[model samples]
Target: MPHLVILYTANLNFPTEEGGDMSGLCRALADTMIAQRDETDKPVFPVGGVRVLAYPAAHFAVADGSGDFGFIYLQLRMGRGRSEWVQQRVGAALVASAKECLAVLLTRQAVGVTLQIDVGAEVFDGKLGNLHPLFK
Candidate 1:
């Protein structure tokens, strides 16, 4: 299972101007993960297991205080047992996808984007959902 969470500054875009399309960004990220493949060209991640969510920070402070500064932090959580290569592939793909999604915002303002991947403890993690139907 893989879950992607994106947290971004609220000022990244004008509130009245659609606010940078978080939903579309999430979709792009999830799609990128679902499309990853291994050396043999087999799918690396389960398409049904991808989930993406985005949150806007209501209050925050940037180093310059120009209000033109923005940040997008991505946290990816997944079950353990994947190789380092796989993780790198997924991370790289996600960062590229995120950049494309936020291209306009980045060009208009100073933005910092970061991505982190967390391997969840198998003993503590639990899942009870069915998204296989969509993948089928």
Candidate 2:
């Protein structure tokens, strides 16, 4: 399972004629993650377990007080047990997807983008709902 949390500065205006909407960006990122495949060419992540959410920071200071400075931070959480190489591959793929999604905003304004992946303890992680059927 993988959950993506997007945090962005409120100074940024989404859905601008120049920049795309945040909701759309989130969906693209989620789809990108779901498309990831392993060495065997099989889906790396469970399609039904992918989730993407975004939060706008109402109050944030980016390097300087200049409102022109914006940022998008992504926190990715997933179950443990993958190899280091796989983890790196997934992280890189996700970040590339994010960059592509925010390309317009990044080129038009001064924006910082970052992604972090966290593998949770298998023992503590719990799941109740099922979206697997939909994927099947």
Candidate 3:
């Protein structure tokens, strides 16, 4: 189970150029996650459990109190049981995809992007949903 959450400043609205929308960025990253594979060419994450979400912070302060500065923070949380190599590979893919998706926005504005991965440490986790059935 791998979930990617993105948080960005509200001022960093989607650029006017193509592929500059928030939904498109989320979808592209999710697609990138779906395409990841291990050293043996096995799927990195279960498609049924893969999720991507993005939210804009309406209230926030950027560096130097400049409202023109924008930043995007991406965090991928997943259950433990994968090799470091696999994790690195997945991280690279996700970051590359994100950069590509935000290319237009980056050029037009001052943007900072950060990607982080959080491995399992869950004391308790539970889920109840029909989405898994659709994937199965």
Candidate 4:
């Protein structure tokens, strides 16, 4: 089965919700995403055991104490290569939601409008794999 890795981020100084307010925002975004998926089939959002990561930028620790927060990824983890359309759709939705969530949590200047999403496959360590052992 295909799995999803979700990362939820927020500014350190970005006012923390006292009564689980932030959770609501996350749910809203997730719900929005689930709604956009093809309902004719299966559920997009994970029912349980969802992988989540948090990325905190050093810049967010500036004088005002605003931590630049972001999610590492919310990508599909499957044996089969992820489909372009699926990645694009999910990425777009996540980015939009993150930016909106940040804006609501912090000031416009503090919340960056741009989001950068990358996959491990996009980078290499210059190490040869078993297939290239003989060649090396």
Range of the 10 consecutive residues with the lowest summed lDDT in candidate 4: 46-55
**Top candidate (TM-score):** 3
Q: Candidate 2 — which residues are off by over 4 angstroms?
A: none
Task: List ranges where model 3 is wrong by over 4 Å.
Answer: none
TM-score of 2: 0.89
Q: Compared with the true structure, what per-residue lDDT tens digits does model 3 show for residues 4-47?
A: 99999988857765657888989999999999988889888888
User: Which TM-score value belongs to model 3?
Assistant: 0.94
TM-score of each: 0.86, 0.89, 0.94, 0.44
How many residue pairs clash in all the candidates, one count each? 0, 0, 0, 3
Please give, for residues 13-111, the per-residue lDDT of candidate 1 as tens digits: 733363547788888998898899877788877888888988999999877795678888999998887888988988999989988788777768888
RMSD of 1: 2.5
Q: Tens digits of per-residue lDDT for model 2 on 1-136?
A: 7889999998775548865878988998898888887777888788889999999999898997755898889999988866777789999988888777777777677888889999978676566876778888
**Which numbered prediction scores highest in lDDT against the true structure?**
3
State the lDDT at 81 in candidate 1: 77
Candidate 1 shows a clash count of 0
Of candidates 3 and 2, the better by TM-score = 3
Better of 1 and 3 by TM-score: 3
- The Cα local distance difference test for each model comes to 0.83, 0.84, 0.89, 0.45
Off by over 4 Å in 4: 1-11, 16-41, 55-79, 113-136
Looking at model 1, residue 122 earns an lDDT score of 74
lDDT for each residue of candidate 4 in 1-136, tens digit (9 for 90 to 100): 2334444334434545432234544565555455445334544443332333334343423334444433333454433344556557766876777666656455523432433434345333343334323323
